[model samples]
Target: MTTDRTNWAGSFSYDARRVHAPRSEDELREIVAASTRVRALGSRHSFSQVANTDGDLVSLADLPRTVSVDAAGSTVTVAAGMRYGEVCRELHEHGFAMHNLGSLPHISMAGAVATATHGSGDGNASLASAVSALEMVTADGELVTVDRDADAERFGGMVVALGALGIVVRMTLDVVPTFEVRQDVYEGLALDTFEKNADEIFAGAYSVSLFTDFVAPTMTAWLKSRVDDVDPAGPDPDWMGARRAASAHHPVPGMSAESCTGQLGVPGPWYDRLPHFRLDFTPSNGAELQSEYLVPRAAAADALRALHGIGEHIAPVLQICELRTVAADEQWLSPAYRQDVVAFHFTWVRDAAAVMPVLKLMEQQLAPYYARPHWGKLFTHEPGHLRSLFPRLSDFRALRHELDPRGTFGNAFVDQHIG
Candidate 1:
């Protein structure tokens, strides 16, 4: 096993025996067919061992990066290893953009989609919702292509397959005409105001994100509005009892804004404004631990209150906490499946020993809401409870077994939770 390899966060070392970077799909197919077991490693952004394997790990970094845009079809096909930043820039040049992007654009498209990583907006769904087609090397080392139209029966399960089925190589995502967005930030919004008008506040812009410490009931709200849809000049100095910031601010308190995207109502390309961080720099306090739970929107008030009760204790090891909304989707294992959700995301100090107890307490508080943890983040949810949350768990297992009956692409993480 490689002792020198680690994830981006530098918190965990991979147990992979060897990592292969193939320059071509032909080579990838060969590696997959010859190996006893394998798993694809993208940017290694996940905090968990979701991407790790006891056997060989396949890396697509060496493959020739390709982006093919089908303007007429409203789709753009890209090498699965490409990051959202890379794809977005090229697409913007060609007058197109994806529906939404996560907080960091550096995440690989394949990894983000597989884990149901989502962006915030009352109307926007998770990133996987844009997947209409994909190509992957299955367990048998055969090339298989599937799309929504042709594979209606199984497409929902494919988009968020959790790296259990195969090593995806290329993905075709839905796109729209390029647009401009302006971001504005407001601070000290009262907890009561937010709870009473959560829906309206979220729907007030193209996208909205609220950041807090929980040590206090107040939080900051970031509103990103499409230029064509809202005033380019932006909100008043005092918006909803929160003062608009006069300068750019990083989501994490006390950090430099150099790495963050432009704010303060600056008009920029959708690709630039949709993500919280810029492509050139590392995202939010580089050394950090993350955990998120997506609970039904109806549970927002009580959920917030639960965390508020212990806010003082949470503020110590916490870097920051964020609240965002996601529209329901059909992805089989997505946290937001079939119900609109308010995602409570936590960026914690890197000490896992200090974070675990607090994390479990937070989970217990939200358990009554049936909160579903993000697949790629740190969580202690047991196998059965997790399986009960996703109605299509059995179907996803059937699909995975059909593609990899021998568990060629499976890992301990997938087996523990899925089996």
Candidate 2:
């Protein structure tokens, strides 16, 4: 099929000559080998041009949506095009679940893995960490399979490749027994109190998120705690100086809470509670731009202070800013690689012209903390500076060249930021 397409946020219009959806692996391979320039498109959730290409944009939507659970091995293999919500339901029905999930369940499995997307938790690693093995179609139309146990070195460089490698077809992810979770939203959390008890606040739940406009006197906190792991009575009335919301809340202020998951400390299935938004509803502000920076946990306090200092400048184009934590992982290109990190995510009003300057200022202010930008979000950092932030960047580039010798997957986004 052929048509002009824009990303989910409508921030970018793909410039691909054609869009192709293959019905089978054989057809996908043929399209990959014949195209001069190509990139895999998944869910179109990204705000950046990472998935853009001048030749052809290949969508795996037509591929069979298959999920096979290896009960004995405690793993589930799924098609790359399948969304997390779709896979999570199947796993829950079979008495299994993934270790973690991002804020939106509508994101495609392969896309989330490729970008090292994550949820908020002190112990939980990025989504890519759960992947034990994956299958991809390389530039030469050759199918390649790599597993963490057998191809440790190469697998580390491939998981968060920013689509500089190849088109992933299937992935085998680790699974655990299904469990229940309860979510609570607290309002009026002062910046001073949060700074003093950040650790204690985040430790209060399995996953914690803070939302703010930066200039506000207080921020909103969303806490998701496992039913079996935490207190049965639920969170306290006065949680670190913040009071529980009397009703459900959307992350963005004044918006209807209709799209949000069950709140008010009600117990529900893990798949329903983990993600902030329900699968059937649009996630976050419908028209928005996002940018996130992950700084080492050690620099959390300092990073928050720096951003607060520039609140006046950022408040104009901002919709809401979220702060979450991510544990360290071994993936070479992951933003949280090798260190526990606190991510400051911005959901900005969709005005690229005004937001770009603020983003550049953020990178400058947080440079001392060695902040790394999320691969799929909008960022203004130069390749040289970003290379310095990631110690294994050179190794990843070498792996990219080896797998895609002709740079079939390379685009302006990859060439400018990764090459």
lDDT of 1 by residue, 167-246 (tens): 99999999999999999999889988998887788787889999988776688999998989975566677877889988
* Model 1 whole-model lDDT (C-alpha atoms): 0.89
Clashing pairs in 2: none
Stretch of 10 with least lDDT, candidate 1 = 1-10
Per-candidate local distance difference test: 0.89, 0.90
- Cα lDDT for residue 412, candidate 1: 93
lDDT of 2 by residue, 40-146 (tens): 99988898888988888998888999999999999999998899999999999999999889999999999999998999999999999999998999998999998
Clashing pairs in 1: none
**TM-scores of all candidate predictions against the true structure:** 0.97, 0.98
